[model samples]
Target: MTRIRLLTVAWLVLFPLAGLADYLEVRRETAVYKEPSKKSEKLVTVDPAERSPYLLKLASGAKTKGYYQVNLPGANEKGWIYQSYVRRYKGQHPGYVAYKRTFYKHWIDEDGDCQDTRQEVLIRDADAKVAYQDEDHCKVEASAWKDPYTGKTFTNPKDLDVDHVVPLKNAHESGAWTWSAERKKQYANYLQYEKHLLAVSASENRKKADKGPDRYMPPNAAYHCEYVRIWTKIKRDWELEMTEAEGEKVQQILENCN
Candidate 1:
């Protein structure tokens, strides 16, 4: 009777059609942790080779913030892994390689709404209703935005630059170089996460161009904590690597958050 019950349980875990969303295959060797945060204890490493780790996603929702609870194959262990590490398994390998800035092009109209990513960001982050030049609302003429990096406010949309918190070059050097071009485009124009992109003064954006926290921070010291926090979160979310000096500077700034 116990053997029958054990088999039933295994069947439910293996083929959870009722609650299952899909399966994700590990593309890279990544660690599953007891919690979603990297600060939490690591439970096990899920490698693409050997057993070739595949995770069964039991539900549509993440188990924790930014993590999915997955049933790891053959290990009889279940743990949370960052969603970024897993891609939906469809029998085709993604062929991930290291990111190069040349691999990516500037933002296009991904949603086909006629507005390109820059215009979309300008409209979305604007403090007031954005003024459009044409009838299609594709071209942004003006808007009010406060630049977090410089603590300066601007009324003209041309004065603001849509900045990638972790610049494309930095991302390429970190882990993004290994991602597909589609993924790189998504990262470049990511607006779903507020931390990923910002409308800042063009001068400030140029000052921070492609440099990490170690080399440059916002000129406004008052914005240091918030800037570092957003920068840290973006790097962590994307699983990007930070140099020792960059990491230390970010940590010091983060301490000021308290």
Candidate 2:
């Protein structure tokens, strides 16, 4: 088994492909897999104490969705590692703090579509025809969005904020503090589901900033059930924990949901 793994690693090293950039430090110890999928064979374990590994960005058969192709240290082995367990290393250690806006970078255009995650959400959730600022259709100039929290309507994009239903700080406190920087970015700019991010009135979002259901609920009582529903869903999707008060409040709100 070990000989076969060594042969595979040697093949990759002999014919290195292109687009291999970025060094990633293991935030937590995790296994290196023969393929990108977790169901694939596990070849080796990466420890946090070892020097950071290099992430191959675009090598042929190297990178896959949500995983990075890496060359392990002290061996000739190459395997795919889950991106969540590693961070792009810049000489800084991994750590997160509550309400730390500086730690997460939102509005990333991971798809290379010129339109960032923020603009994409604004365009998607708009109730009316969205106006584009440029020919590329990347920037959203104006749009009408209804705030679920305040029941307010705004035609200007500036009036609305793309709110993380489970705010960054809240997630950090719950369990994200242990996550790598890459994982935090994924949570902040998550576009997998509409409920994860919402277009809401800026003022209302500020009022509810980083507060869980225990301490805060939307001012628009009619939307309380939906708000809590989205909140609970986000927490569950990310495997976050809820405080006793938060759990009780969410349960109460759910009971009132029609």
Report the number of the highest-lDDT candidate. Answer: 2
- The lDDT for every candidate, in the order shown, is 0.67, 0.69
TM-score of 2: 0.63
Put down candidate 1 lDDT per residue, 61-166, tens digits, no spaces. 5457878776543233466778788876532234434445668766789889999988888888889878899999989998799888888889988788899988
Give the true-structure RMSD of model 2. 13.9
lDDT of 2 at 133: 94
> Among these predicted structures, which one has the highest TM-score?
1
